[model samples]
Target: MRRLAVLGGVSIALVAAAACAVSEDVSSPPHEEPEQSIPDADVREVAVGSDAPAPTRGLLCSSDGWCETLLPDPDLVVRDIWPFSDRAFAIAESFTSGIKVLEWTSTDSTWRYIDDNSQNEALAELAVGIWAPSADEVYYAVSPGTIYRGTRPVAPATAWSWSSERLPDNNPANVNHGDATQRRLTLGVWGTGSDDVYAWYSNTIFHRKSEGGGAPAWVPELIADDFDAPDEHIFITGAAGKSPNDVWFAGSRRRGTKEPCDVLVRKTPEGYRRIADGVVPELYSDPCTAREGIPQVVGGPRAWPRKFQSLDGERFFALKSWNNFLRIEPDGDGYSVNIANVPKTLLDAPNLISLWGESEDRLWLGSTFFNSNRGVVVRGSQVWGDGGVYEYSSIALNGAPSNGPPNQIRGTSNTNLWAVGDRYALHKTTP
Candidate 1:
């Protein structure tokens, strides 16, 4: 198998040497630094509204605590939410049909369905990812690697115009194009700006760059082959970045059902390269065989990373397992990995699947399950001097129904946050 060469003049041997010094064993307890002082946790009020609506379907709340059901249809299962200053956009799946795009503006104070009629039902049903940099521009990704771009029309044209394109299909034999059973589904879409956007499926990362001309088309920027993996496939589950020059993709490499190892690659001005692997010594063993005797990495994440989000591009947080997460940041010329546990005391639920934040000090996480009684959302604040420790607190959802957990959490700022999942959507805004 082929391995990536050294990055930015730093050889992989040198990178490994530097990582060994700071890398924590996943099985061991957190190493405390006695010389470092932990910062005091920030305090904020939990506002309760007098006429708050019951969180039966979902709830929207302000900082002072006024809440109401935010979904236009109670049966819609919101998959993701993108909040803006004057409006917000969401993609939700219904019990009877596939996914639908909805919009809510400050002027209207209501959610409106905005998907194009030209989009076929098959593609619509596969829509799972949505990202909007502004009200005028949005990008949606569907299963089996199809992307749709929607743009608001000028005056005299009240409707938005949409164009669709498909990402390269490596395994076209998988006709189902489903995410769970196949590798065709587009996992997520994100970008620093509308002109430079990105979308990724299982093993390929697609890029669309428009340069002062008509519309540009999505093109394959990177693939699993570029990494020279021992296995035929690498599962890329999430993507995030600070800018066009600095983007990150994370996932795992599996030798069939056994011997799974972490895979992390970053894209810089230089190009894309793998920075770290086999992070947990126990799990990072022999990629060629289904070996059983290899020791498991202790204190490391319970599973491979499935999602990632960055607060400052400097520090990226990844959701690996139900109660465990990872903090990846630059270390010298390369990068280092730090595994941290979620404070069980702070979470009422188990599956913390969604992650978002306004800054390094303030972060938010959401839990998920079909029929969870307590839809939990936890806010984490960094404890200074501690290697990536945080003080976590469960945000109170005063009128929220115990119907289901949140699948996603997003916000424009610390005071304005939104969490949507199952059959509900919750919003927190300034009073």
Candidate 2:
């Protein structure tokens, strides 16, 4: 669910930080590069990808910012932002036929190829994220349920030939893991020599002991039928809570009118149990009211890998709001909910409230309003980015916070945190 850079009047803020070495000026060589056709060399067209273009109708962004239009291809959709090392921009770009990774370096923002593996014409492995069971290499999931991957440092994906590798189930075109399409699989990523993976795609609300696998397993045991995630549109929004035992999976359920939607959360223990729904207002065109298009769940996405608020034993609370915020507390049987409206102290703020997290004591909230998707600054009842009660001190920032804005954030250790999603991924430590 990537927001394609479209034709918009985007506000371009040239943060003269160290990253802009990404500009073509620094990446391109003396004479080997192609002539710049567009005015803004900052924005580059994805030569090969499956991501669909946004509206042909552009927006009036600020002066100079990054934006692009959605193409006519129906299969095209930006899958996920590739993880980064020290000097590379790794990206997962999809195609109607297959998937590929467009890799580039800071020295040259020109994206090259990472993996051009064997393809299955019958089974177009629409690759998603790269998981590391260990550090030796990385593997890309063709999709969530099916786990086909390549070792790290994926190459230009052009060599793939369909009908090559065989699966244990013998199903080449594996899309859904089991008989259940209702279940969205989430990987319990682990590491050995490389990143190993586990899954949760069960028939009933997934119970902890269930088993699943493709490359990563998708247990059908995790989702309960009573949980109420729409059959078709329902998807895993994120796993909220603090620990594995306390984890809660977030699901988006579409109901009644096509556009109007609701968010669902089911506790992931003993099996799935209903926790709450529609914590945030969903966009709906009443049955009688004429609607223009679908109202999107802005900032609503399954917390990217390492993006959820979970530690070994604690599950962080989850919240979302446009004008207000929603928080939940587990009751003996059900759950108690609290609603907080974004105070004026932070309403007119630059970024919109997307996520909030708290440690044992300090509470932190983050926003990415408009296109200013900056790092989540620790804020209280105040605007983030502009200035917040909590500025990241060098000690707090000792963790290599993604040099770029975290499309998603997750904290594992008191001092170790990980953020993924956006073009640049983050692995930071808080001293």
Candidate 3:
């Protein structure tokens, strides 16, 4: 096991902002775009299907639509992949081998094991999140309040060196009726650069900043008790921002199974503030505890916004309940919220899961249905400006398997796109 470095403290204040709402009725006709067809020669499956020794489950596509799968070990299950221009990094876990970090380069076209978590069971089994600011630097977050940093090796070294840091454990044993273990689990890690990284677990957010002429250290940015009621718990699922001053973190707040509310908080030049609060009907059957309502759709367990992404910092998109999608833009002092539902005329009962885009008018949403073999990718184009409606169309996956759904959609541009999930990876080179 690696020795853990204790972190220092920093004090930050939270400010409550006035809730603002600008609702738009999206009853207009659904906008549609013509789908492109890829030639048989342009698409191919590498190490997928039942015949391969270890099926490729994780994939990364370069800026030019060149795709590769990450499968260094047969028993690994990849949780996340982060890509750079020429190299990529992934986090995978195995019951027998523990946690593994794999690296791939465009030149080699093969995945290589680059991490050293094999001896530490806790680090191996619990590392779930990864983010690379550059090919030389990366950050991995282990659940239960631990983080690891890896830097590229110099000429004499053959491997990367990793250092560990420990965060303040807010989840002491037996708290919240012994369910505090869930709160200790880190959700993810993200940043604009190497110096401005952020990580959030269940309810707490930590920031990594440099001290007086020494290495950067993680410090508590926000804690649950400072923001929520004694009975309420906040589960941060996703985060994104235009820059350090305009970042946003979102998730759901629950006070038992009966009440689940949507949470949207932002960090500006001033400090952290709660900007929006609404209800998540899919998580609870009882009445909503709506304080200031953001748009929501009524449906099953997948109703809440699971992930958030933005091409530019001014506007953001998130996957919502069923076929519905969320669009958030900067409004006067708050944000303008719009919930766009997939037209029933296009598809029936599609559960949108992943989102990626190149601009406000050009977006791709990935959908997978319950008890179904195939999934669909929907393209959304803005029909107007903020609070306006979006036109959506279905994109066909030519070589992807029937049983696979695009769990994640990412690309450098519309001309070079990739959708990967469920043992399959699909790439599109045409706009």
- Per-residue lDDT of 1-431 in model 1, one digit per residue for the tens? 11222322222221242222112112312223232221211112212112212345544443434244456566777777888987788877776645677787667456777776333443344447689878888887665456777877686766667777655544223222334423322366889887668887666677887547855766566665422334334557778877888888776654444455666667887776665454222334433321132211223443567557786677887776776666666655555555544554544347766777667656676764333545666666562224334443334456445356676788888656777776666656652
**TM-score per model over all chains:** 0.74, 0.44, 0.71
Worst 10-residue lDDT window, candidate 2: 14-23
Against the reference, the lDDT scores of all candidates come to: 0.58, 0.33, 0.56
lDDT of 2 at 47: 30
Best by TM-score: 1
Q: Which stretches of candidate 2 lie over 4 Å from their true place?
A: 1-145, 148-219, 222-233, 240-247, 256-270, 277-308, 312-315, 322-326, 332-334, 339-366, 369-405, 411-431
Point out where model 1 deviates above 4 Å: 1-66, 118-120, 171-186, 210-215, 226-232, 279-299, 368-373, 383-400
Give lDDT tens digits, candidate 3, residues 73-140: 55665555676556667665667657667676667556677776522533323555678888898887
Per-residue lDDT of 406-429 in model 2, one digit per residue for the tens? 333334343443333333333343
Ranking by lDDT: 1, 3, 2
Evaluated at residue 213, the lDDT of candidate 3 is 80
lDDT of 2: 0.33
Model 3 misplaced regions, further than 4 Å: 1-70, 118-120, 169-186, 212-214, 226-230, 278-303, 373-376, 383-403, 424-428
